[model samples]
Target: MEIKLEEKKIKLVLIILFLGMILPIFLTHQNFKIYDSITKALELWDKEHLLIGMLKLVIMNTLRSIPMYIAIFLLFDSIEIIKNGRKRNFEKVLLILPIIPIAYSLIKIFYDIQLPVGKTSILGVLWFCYYVKFDLKNITYVEKYLVFLSFIVGLQWLDVSRFFNFLGVGEITSDLNKAIIFMEADVIVTLICISFFSFFTLFSILLLHFFKGQEERIARSRSEMENRHLKEVQLLVHDLKTPIFSVGALLETLTLQEEDERKKLYLKKMEDSIEKTNVMISEILSVKSEKPIVIEEMMRFIFSFLSVHKNIEGITYKSYLKKDYKLKGNRILLSRVIINLIVNSWEANSSVVNIMVKDYKKRLIIQIDDCGDGIDIDNINELIKEGVSTKNSSGKGLSFVVKTIKEMEGKIYFVKKIKNGTKIYIILKGDEYGE
Candidate 1:
């Protein structure tokens, strides 16, 4: 099923992807070979010692692998159903099925059970192909972590970590006289296999997430700098406009005062030259002169403007300013955002673009909806990125939307329907709601 990639459901998918990649090898680690490896490695090669090490590996492997594998399948299927956007009951019902795998894993780990009679490598490989092609990586976190897990586990050589007795409990000891299930595998071998896959699985997730966050942060900082640069260029152009306009104005005055037709024409020519310069400056300045402020004032101005625009009579803009939520943007910059959205909506053939404030749970939500040609199928997200534009814009409107929202310490995204227009959703932290 096509699970829409939303932020909330990321963790579940990541867990599944991780397990699908790592579990088979992980569970197999605790199989019979470990008993031989440890017994041989330690020179305690007799049956008693072999059984002891093998049993320990089996128990520990079961403890880590069972619950983990169960978690993997449960979360994976839940995410699958959610991705499909299917009937809720089946998703809900299927959610609990993870418990059985979890129970199996846990019971094997913590309780005394004969190791199941199958080679675990087959299980590992089966789960591999299951997730490999599923490719549910439209989500960022999933894409980042799953790829990392698959790569690390692929070599099958970097197996790491062994003991996990954090439960503070020892394994249940079998009586000395009892023969364990037609034991084929050794303890140390199983432990090594389990340790390799299990450690790689667990550790790789933590590592990938940590790095992805850092990379995102760095990317964000780079983006913010670019916006600041845009603003800076605007400042430089705005600074230049006054002198250019002054020169053009002086030339215009000369043309009005001149009695000689030739001189009048020449003065008019100079006026035209500098006038173009002034126009370019204005467009440049129009985007650059920005500061930061609270959200309400901006909405108030936009809605107030929309209330009067004769061309926009059929369209309505609404505001939902929360009493306590505040944003880190100033009036001028925020006003520009409202104006741009309104204009873009109108341009896109939408009779109306709804602009409203909402309590997006703990965060503040500023939503812009328009019944226009929804965003271009391919470039909705592209537009928010720097240097991407449909109109060959100063290429700044939506980028401005993104920049301003971020300056306000918020985020903005477009949910565009394939046929209709788009919904621009911005979530901002105010008093960091539910903080």
Candidate 2:
């Protein structure tokens, strides 16, 4: 969805750019046409000048329309032709579609003209290419340049009548012969106009390339900074984990050796808190790690973790475990995910939480539903984004959960409940029962 939004913005920018490019041409054409009409009022408005003026208008209009033409083509993602429940071949259809009208138009305008109709409308195939996911933007730079060159050539071909006359190849009419003295002057002026416009287009392309280069450099810098920050974070997490491990081991030893009831209870609580911290630290560090874990053992650990939390101890809940399955991922990471979700539910002041685990043919589906004021529909998409949360905490829990699930090639999504709370569904790929 985000990618689609970005693409839409790009299209809008291109539309604005193309409109800007065409606006000047229209203004210039209108200004020149008025000036020329006034100056050449008494002069003979003969066949040659008429042809020249028409051809110039055609070329300018076609040039102005190029961007909009491409934009219109981009509006369709796919084009399918079906007849009698059978899909026809699209390749052949698109190749022939644009040429038919262009051929007719050309022939009607210039009965004696000759040009390759198929080759002239080659750019038209870009429409088909776009629909089939073969956009010009995806091609190599050199190939893109070649395509642009082809487009220029095609535009010239569309004005083949003027092109041939400029080349001194077309049949001469008696009316034009009478005005032959002015023909050389007209041809020279037309050539100059074409040359100027060509240079302008070239300059625009070069300017676009300069912008593209700057954008690429900025993207590269951002990627480098992200990589550096990731490395620093990994190092810091590793350093923190070493002391946490030692403390946890020492706490375990002390709790096992102590015999006094009050001291043992206090020690046990401390040990549980330390163990939870260790699990959270491990979750942060090894969220991407995929190790074999038994689902039943992980669930037992999750229940133990929840029992220690004061908030969740009083909440009514139901659990249905169809079967325990083996998954390949960090056990602590999954535990952290469940803990974050359960905590969120408790914070929402949910009276009841339902947990369901199902083993499928090739995946495991876990659903957690709560009966509190549900998440706002507007905030659903933003829930897993970093720095976004209902609680006033760091808001990294759900984000971390999302990242871990993605690393495991799993999916986590919200299923809106009918009553008041939110329902979160987690699907993880794993071996089917007895498979």
Candidate 3:
């Protein structure tokens, strides 16, 4: 609702703030002071006070550069969030976000026009954190190279002087130099050094950014490969888990028929071991399961499954929904989550299992109600994390449940109920079900 909309608006404002910071310097470089866009820009520079004027230039330039890195960094970090109607990649999305005040700043700085910016932004803070997290090592490498580049720039500045015309652009002519009263050798030489340094500084920033991007790309590729390997392992585990359960059942049948008492005991132990092995297999398969089916029929299939596997002992199960609900996701994975939740409830001495469903625009809000000794308040969040277990068996099953919900972009939270039962709410987004 309004809160979500406001959050998006806030992020948009921050983006503009960051974009504005870098716009001036980039535009200045590109425009070459032809003096068109922001003609008032030079007003900020006091020529009579050269120190103030130089400070104005440096401050404005750095302000503009910081946000450029931030916008670029966030663009990469959130590349996968393709929401609403935009399916654009990170680069395309950033391109759509405004250009680095390129042509406009160039025209303005040359004409001394100031570009007015609106509002404050945290892009400076955002980029500082990001650089420290991911780019510092690479930036240091670039800085080390920049030290050598500085010397080279100084030598090149010399070549553009006297008879050593490396760039032959413009050197002091004797007649023009004599006409300028303030043009002392010291002042002119200082200006040349400043300009030379500025050029090298900007060049180094761009080079560092480019290398940082390369490092990120390499990191992502390595991550994707690791996920691929994990998925392969998961599939292999799935193949192994299903048959172990069947083998366990076969062993149970043999145990009942065995005449020797010792042999029967051994058969029972084998059956128990097979069952334990099967659970482990399930845990492994849970790691890499794919998207769930969202059809109404599939949800029905899941309810029917619970009915078929209804506890023959002291446990009881109930389907509380009035009508069928539809969700897009892997039915198998969803079923596993449901089974684990129900098993946990049963273990907590709950005889009744209530599955309630409600329509939430495009989403289906499902709540599983269990009258049991609810989750430990302190450990609720931890239970969802990997390797966290509240049960006697391997903790992977509960971790898998949390992982599955996250994969679907859904959320799960433990609710404090007036009644003694625990309420676990699962919110599955409508858009995800379609996809």
The best candidate by lDDT is 2
Per residue, candidate 2 scores C-alpha lDDT tens digits across 260-350 of: 8899898887788777776766666754566777777787778877775666555544444434567787888787788788888888888
Task: Please state the error at residue 19 of candidate 1 in Å.
Answer: 6.6
Runs off by more than 4 Å, candidate 3: 1-228, 231-249, 252-327, 340-354, 369-399, 409-423, 429-435
- Sliding window of 10 residues with minimal summed lDDT for model 3: 116-125
* Superior candidate under lDDT, 1 versus 2: 2
Which residue runs of candidate 2 sit more than 4 Å off their true CA positions? 1-230, 241-259, 279-287, 314-323, 432-434
lDDT of 3 by residue, 1-435 (tens): 011112443476466654554465464623432222113323433233333223333344444444444444444333333345333343334442453345235545665645422111122222233343333343343453453343334333333223222322221122222222233334654576457656765674565567678778878887899789888888888777667777877887887788999998778767655654564466466645555454455455455445434552433333333333345566667777877887788777777777766656676576888788777755565676667776766777778888788787776767756768788888776544342
Q: Give Cα distance to truth, residue 66, candidate 2, Å.
A: 10
TM-score of structure candidate 3: 0.43
> Model 2 reaches what TM-score against the true structure?
0.57
Give RMSD to native, each candidate.
Answer: 11.5, 9.4, 12.1
| lDDT value for model 3 | 0.53
lDDT values for all models: 0.54, 0.58, 0.53
For candidate 1, lDDT tens digit of each residue in 104-160? 454556544433322232244344444433343234545444544443352232222
Clashing pairs in 2: none
